[model samples]
Target: MIRRKDTRRMAKRPTKPTKSVEPRRAGRGPSPEKTAQTRRVIIDAALGEFLENGYADTTMDGVARRAGVAKGTSYRYFPAKEALFEAVVREKIAGALIDADPANRRPDEPVSTFIRRTMLVSIREIERNGRAAIARLVLVEGARFPEMTEIYRRAMFEPLLKQIRDLAATARARGELRRPELEDYPHLLIAPIWFAIIHNGLLDRAHPLDIGDLFEAHLDLVFDA
Candidate 1:
């Protein structure tokens, strides 16, 4: 068997070595728990960092460094700073919506008690996480990037609205509400609570009116004693 000289020369030529495979934990392939934990750390760290640093100044590397994960890990979880900020909203702010579920109402609990507990829990979360700072962050960033608004609306607003609306209708039927007219406007029922939150967020002090008085007024205005 005779082969051409060009074929012999081709056979003698050395090939490039394959790239080495990265270790699993080193941003190559992380476990599900590890991945979730990484995301949690990033979100926690990013939220704090953003609150401290403002939006334009926030960098993915800063979040990764704060999270104690590699920069690539932060990027692996989120592609851009916008995505990271959006995750901050979803994780810290919007995630509190879970407490608003009607399922959280205790069996045979008074409607007044349930309303106070639910709204307070939400307010506590908003204040604990950064209050007006977080609210302002969402609004400021959401203005530039509208996806934050949609994420907030779907994640936070819709579920809570449905729960409160159902509660309103139930209260009206049971004659527990003084203002059945407001049942169709469940948002009005909760609007006072949010006003208190927004007031604290923006004013950084009491809004002249005693919040307790205001809340009691809200209850009086809408509910039967």
Candidate 2:
């Protein structure tokens, strides 16, 4: 019953200090969504700058200004004007190529029919979606900027032409195509598209040609349908 004798029980032990946790800061780099958004903004700005000023006059600084991003930001996405132009072609123009790719054709679908469904639809919307403007830009500035021309050709032209050649072979094998000319001249399939693009854009701005109609008419003649 001598409770006062027990000094160990009488004295309260000191409590240990709890460790403080530091608040987590977000990562310094941009998130994936933010990065994609930034890239889209830069690409849109670059396209507008290239269209307004032409490739020769369009500068990375100008594109950044248009994008409202720091010049370095654009450089991070696109190292040079050529690279930016390539991106524009790949993103904006090359997408249509997928629609017309021969690989997407049904086993029984005629080449002409497949093109009418795919390439024709894309051609119909080309002007509405600003693709015609990009094509016009390439046409107007391609000579002055061979690098830009090469980028367009490599990204949009070659792949599409190759697809056309493949389709031509398939058509001939299936008896849908009567001539070997398409295989030799894949450009024939797209000739009307270029002509319509040129005629509507430059030759007759007052009386624009319907690219879809022109391409459809060309198809009729080529397929003899």
Candidate 3:
């Protein structure tokens, strides 16, 4: 489901290590949540700068101005341009990861229900979050920023891949899913969802894709033989 970089924003690292370095230890000040929020705001503004002025053209100063923060504040969050880029990409991808987790679901629910709920959450995340812009950037501009792609593949896409893999394994174990190509079923089921989301952006248009119908049809096609 990766896109050409020209069309979307590049993916970010899924987590930030440096952000965990407490400012209190560094003799700098702010509540942890405040620091996190400020970091997010800076990353958002930096993304805007990168988009408006291509990555090559964007600068820390521009990002600072766009963020309405002092240049020093921007530097505090992302000392290097590469770091800033990574932070921004991670910020977006982490949101997707959060959406994919199904801990909110009831414990007694069926696996199918859990999967359906997770997929619906994912659909909502893709629709409402800034995924379109990020996906397009990754496809088009990502080649120039290899780090971004690496972050995306490892952090963002890999988790989703693992989730599908686990779902397939669970279904097979439960006798609810049987396919000569069992492993591939997960890919077949999930790929279209990702592609549909990406294609929506590429075409510069939006339309609702039915997650429930798509999931059920795939399950029926693969497992109902």
lDDT of 1 by residue, 4-79 (tens): 5776656766779999987677455768898898889999999888899877678888998998999988888899
Candidate 3 accuracy as TM-score: 0.70
Q: lDDT winner among the candidates?
A: 2
Candidate 1 Cα deviation (angstroms), residue 215: 4.0
Candidate 3 positional error at 98, Å: 3.0
- List model 2 lDDT by residue over 114-191, tens digit each: 999999999899988778888888899788878878998899999999999999999999998888999999999899
Candidates in order, TM-scores: namely 0.72, 0.84, 0.70
Candidate 1 TM-score over all chains jointly: 0.72
Off by over 4 Å in 3: 1-28, 50-57, 102-108, 180-185, 203-225
Q: In candidate 3, what are the lDDT values of residues 71-90, reduced to their tens digit?
A: 99989878898888777666
Predicted structure 1: lDDT: 0.72
Question: By summed lDDT, which 10 consecutive residues of candidate 3 come out lowest?
Answer: 96-105
- List the candidate numbers ranked by lDDT, top first: 2, 1, 3
